[model samples]
Target: MGDVTTIRRDVLTLPVADVGPDNPLPPLCPPDEIHRPDERDGEGLPRDMARQIGYGRLRSLLPERLRDGYGRSRAPRAVDTLVIENDRLRATVLPGYGGRVVSLVHKPGDRELLYRNPVFQPADFALNGAWFSGGIEWNTGATGHSTLACAPVHAARVTAPDGGDMLRLWEWERLRDLPFQVDLWLPDGSDFLYAGVRVRNPHERAVPLYWWSNTAVPEDRRVLAPADEAWHFGPERRLRRVPVPVHGGTDRTYPRRSEYPADHFYELPDGRRRWMAAVDADGRGLVQTSTDVLRGRKLFVWGTGSGGRRWQQWLTEPGTEGYCEIQAGLARTQLEHVRLEGESEVAWLEAYGPLTADAGTVHGTDWAAACSDVEERLERRLPRAGFEEAYKAWRTAADTEPGELLATGSGWGALEVLRAGHSLPGTPFDESALGDAQAPWQDLLRSGSLPEPRRAGPPGETLVAPHWRDLLETAPAHPHTEYHLGVAQWHAGDRAQAVRSWERALGLAPSQWPLLRCLAVADLEAGHRERAADRYTDAFDDLCRERRDDGEAWTAATAALGREAVAALLAVGRTAPARSVWERLRPATRRRGRFRLIEAELLLAEGDRDAARAVFDAGFEVADLREGAEAVGALWSRITDEPLPERYDFRMRPSGGGGA
Candidate 1:
């Protein structure tokens, strides 16, 4: 162990000038507009999933009339910020700005490792439209501008177990009703700092959860991770697996902007190799490692010399060079639901710092060889006691049977794999010999290794029955058995049977939204508009009831489903039912100061000019309502033959306008 005397803390501030609010109110999207949340349907995204996945829709709907521009307000200047350093490394955390790690420097070389933003500026880039770039952005709760991301958190400095300094930042996630805390511990002599995160759910009901740490490094650096294959998302939204480290005859681990921006995923198969790095050619850079809890690695960069990349630079700062994100996620990717049981808490530790290549002969541009160099350096730089013990523990955990780990409560975040309704291989036993099939089939279902349905062809009823029939015959009580049976039934084009299976699954898991959503979709596709609307509403109500304090979640759901449900009713010319949905969602929408334009449009469609004007006045900005204003104006002109209200000024028309 090294001496504890070397740990120190200092305060420095990076001067910030407020850019004004978002300027020129953005337009309102039609209530029924379909926006795909992810490459897929976002079937079961966990809480705290990254904001980029469909959460941005919430912000796009709420128009920001005026935006603050960072360029004109102030010049770059040094200001007070928080710093914690040991003998080997220095790390700075901005307490005033969402507790982001604004800087991390290697003490030996006096080199800055993190991509530090030159100006403290924010743009409407996040889901809820307020995010600053660079550094490490800790995301928690269900995506978007997490209530905690931009808000000030509770910060404190305390002594670590080894008598070193530790900085603790914590916040209560108001939206999900969870409390999350992080401790940044810089030991006296270690080259790396440990970031320990803890999230606790106080409620008795299990809730879906998500957590990710996004670290920004210079774009010139190469990234490396231990993985055999990578997932390639095609243009048509299919995932293809290719060998990692090298893909398409190129080394993908190296950072270079692409012609088109894309996100690449590498699965950390087991605990032993759950680490990634951003390094230069000489094998010198930062390495990030985490416990099995954070098993996903992502490499993302804005395409080189693209308009979007240029715009990003301009939004963050002028002369801002490009940077790539090396992200560590709690799961393989965002949006997959990970259940956090009631009153349970999950914790994990992540560490990253500088690596100095030594002893190893430099090999030709091989990522594996580079990783070996870093590993050797890590073994030498980390104290024997800490490094040896952690390595042993990780190896032991990694070596454990994957199924045994699940049984022992070790793979809590990976429960998504256990979701029922997956398809399975057909048994050799004859279909008439149902009694002989049950015992063997139940074991397969219990193993959670059933293959997912192939989307290549239309659902085949004959193919769907054999696998699930055996399980249902053998284990009728298993909800997952019913769930999988339902999915198979749906695929086979047996809608009635599929609904029956889903109903059974719901009986077993009442709050499970996927089952409800699947049923609703089936209803909608079958032209049962009223039934579909009711089912959608029920699922929406269940979601809101579970997360009552989360208005953003409510807003997201309203935009994604509630509005669609209402539109489905309207599409079928069912005005009374549509009005009911509008009324039920009015409180939350009004609280967010949105959707009044849609409400007005609905009213105008019904020829209720007086009521439409009332809602329009409540929701529209007198100066920036634009097309919504004109639509309302035209309707009132036709109905009442009156001049526009004085508040409505159409003198300076924008290039275009449209109906709400």
Candidate 2:
């Protein structure tokens, strides 16, 4: 490593807005639609009955990427690549390609240290639908490839505090309506590229969000991270956590030898170290290190010869080329749930550099071996101060608050933290990431003193301050801000403007059920019965997209939508669809008992008291429902004007309500 302390920046030509039709970029193709077995089998029935009815079903059919050519080629073909180079390394940034670090070259050998995909291929692969793999991708906002992946960001070359060249990339994430930035600094004489990241929720309400820095490398490398166990989706898509590298006494780490395609997420055993590496067959590769804020380390390998590899290659290119990812995240894996507090920002730093170790020394499951390799490559053992120094550097550079540095662990330790009611860093942000502030007014209109706009307004007579428009103007792409604007416009007697705002919001965050539901309510108020029914149906479908394991959200959706949905289906003589709703809502009771009440109510409404009693008994077997059953029984008694028999402990009561 050189000792000079200067920095330099080289800016390339600016990227063009759109590629010409004659360009060699791959033709855009729509992703294959997701079709469940039942849906596929329903094809023989009448058109209405042939379609599966659910929020998830409807959402799965909605087009993810826009069909127009302009939307398909939204990302520019030519990028204004920025180069931050020093004597030891050169890092290139593609500001147009999601501000990705497209290349990290080891200056000595003039060889690429990170995987550089030969072609710039964007496909419908990310959660928001478009994604491109390779180099270091800043995945912020939610899981998958992030909204910015393959999209342009605001980038500039700046001077670091240490007088080094820094490349800063940032953009507003429209889905979550938040601002985030990544600053890359490579000192004149250093081998590593240091990255500082900040995600801010300017509003008083906090939102859920996920972030990760995904670095891709050639598949011939072996990953060495501090982990004793690995979690992956096993048979039947069930998550199974087993010993790392070897599951069921079978080596499962490398791609060349695996029988089937496997996605392995290792639980980082040492959060204090905050580092992981991928060493190639030549004993040379890259080392990724970060502050405690970026504690999670993940390794993903697509089998050398498998269906998964073919599927991925089909999107990138048809070839034998394979790659693996070494990701640094704020949680155990990138998919874990995380929340950002209102008016708070999360800041962290990470580094990537070339590393060389003795051949055959890398071991994926052994933490000691991995640390030894890092020590050998760096020529220094990381002492306690090493960790503290990194933390101090991140804190000082980002001007972060001490209280905001969450004291958490990695891997299972993070899982334990989540189980304890505290948010883990880098987890997937969900709709509930808004903390407790679900109301759009609290997020957009409230000035900390004003009353929230009521839904049952004097029929669209609620007042909105002029500043609220300014907020919307500043965050034009924010779905929540747009939603609030729509409500305010409706109240101010601007129904057309309200619909336009809502339509825009829906386009940005199609799965946000509240937005869909609100739109439906507005339609109903305007006597647009067909539009209202369609919006309500879309809202219900959107709610189904929530992971079933999220019991609170799942149950809440079922409780809010189930009764009306079931009644409507039954009223139309759609018993099968009504039964399906009950079955779909059944899993909600496994973790929480709220949905059990809905099931009981549905049964009782159908004049099946015996079945309702049976449902309650079964619900108790699945979850602890003492409190829920008591509440449900009380509601039932009031609604039916019937007093319950004494000594009836719903938790321990006999099935069929003691042979009532």
Candidate 3:
């Protein structure tokens, strides 16, 4: 309530005080304001402040003692560790903790500076060099430590102005142990960090506490979250809360660089959970957080706006200094019994750091983890007996239908059986076996007739029925089946037959995704560049509409087909068309190393070596996809007509080549 500027500076020095009789006092300084001195020289200004003050300020604050300390402790022992498991994404967790993560490093390599551990000096609490009166308190009580007491869990000493070191502390508590279990990973290679913290009340007495993860963002960082309503509590308790829908859109937080003073809280309606992001202005990097549980949680974002007043305004600014505080339960006592009990027993918290600047790079990792999480949750909610029974029924139906089709000697009868199999409601097609089905279908297309019945059909029908008659009588002759049949022919070396089958498939299901995809591949293999480009374009368009809801198959298909489409478009001298396709697909495709090689090809065609090299650099980061990268390198060598690195190899290699 004193001068707002002074309050922002003094907030961290003050002892934990109760905001109410029951709740622990909210910390004074915002969580992000805590400093780390070892990384920086003097007063450990939060990352945002350091940026505003300029690196020159950082250089001037270079404390001699800290410099000497860093020189000696550059390879300090692992203070904390988190090991990502096979089930969890290795990429997300490795980059998230920055340098503090000693056990796991991302596949390509880690980002510099962002990932290093920070050091702290006590005087960092004050804007000036004077030592502050605060110290981190590690406390636990029989009633469980108050959420407010959870602050000061992590602290750092960073360089300050005037050649001194300042202490910066992060106030958030670790819900899980360091090196805890990672439950899942997105196909894109990002990880999901999950930890459960238990809060216990040994005295058997009810306790009231307000809990919020003091998630801090650098000063110039942006914090975005899903919201149904937002409220501001400041200016002598003048509270203003408004209703809104929960969604992603334009900047809703402080949008301008100047409006800094603001403190606000948002309430999510029941059954809603939100994903929040802390991003820099240019969108180059971001730190994202979310609560996995669907129970409604409160969001609190407070920070000094561009106006230089910390926690003042309610409006959002696109680029500004601020941080987001996320709260769950209004007060410790108010949290639902389940949440309290969960917290008492074990509370789960996860954090994924900034994915690379290219959105596509992170998409796979994000989606994989997301899908796994949803699947697990769904399974947990389903009745075990009913679920098991349903699963078994679907599998049996799929298997039996295939068997029945082979037993029908007449080709039309077999087609009818297969169609019925495909149409069975709720059949869980073994997607993993899809590749297996390709060979038989291809062989049939090549032979143009069944050479022998694997199993004899009903006694009256001949196995070699008229093709046209069979097509007319078969179950709708859907495009998907025809496409697979084409793939079978292609694999059998009957290119002409393969093309015909694919064309037939397209005729039945003009917009069927799988059919269109096969057509595109057929066109490519046949050296029909323009046709391939057109097919690829159409298939990609269809995929875009369904990407969000579909599972891994859709994701992988979309990315793979989209990349090929881009390459085909480029190959046909449709540079402009290629560019458009590239633009649309780049965000999702560029993350994997193979896409980079394709991108490099497109760039090289444009005579932009610089851009092509940049793409290559990105590809090299991926450990598994290096074959594509090497192929591209070989292409580059061909362009120069000179053998370069030993890694270059031109012949196409199998896909899915990279490893962590």
- Please provide TM-scores, in order, for all candidate models, with all chains considered together: 0.54, 0.55, 0.28
lDDT scores of the candidates, listed in order: 0.54, 0.55, 0.34
| Index of the highest-TM-score prediction | 2
Global CA lDDT of candidate 3, please?
0.34
Model 1 lDDT on a 0 to 1 scale: 0.54
lDDT of 2 by residue, 1-660 (tens): 354433333444422223111111111222232211233334443243222122111111111222111111224344456677777787887776677888899889887888887656444455444466689998875545664666666555454646544566655564455567677776556678878888877555666667788999887777776677765632122345678666766666555555444456666655346777777777788888777777677776655433345444533455636777888887565445366788788887787888887765664446467657775565453343554565465445453211211111112212222222333233222232232223443443334332333431111111232344445555445665566566656544566887788788777663466666667666665676666556555566666764345443344444445544564555445555566666765453323344555566667666788777776556432121221124554545634545543323232122323211
Cα lDDT over the full model 2: 0.55
Q: For model 3, how does the per-residue alpha-carbon lDDT over 202-260 read when each residue is reduced to its tens digit?
A: 11233322233333334444334445465443322233454432223423443333222
lDDT of 1 at 39: 51
Every model: Cα RMSD to truth: 16.4, 19.0, 28.7
Summed backbone clashes in each candidate are 22, 9, 94
Q: How many clashes show up in model 1?
A: 22
User: Which stretches of candidate 2 lie above 4 Å from their native place?
Assistant: 1-77, 234-236, 259-261, 270-272, 363-371, 375-391, 399-660
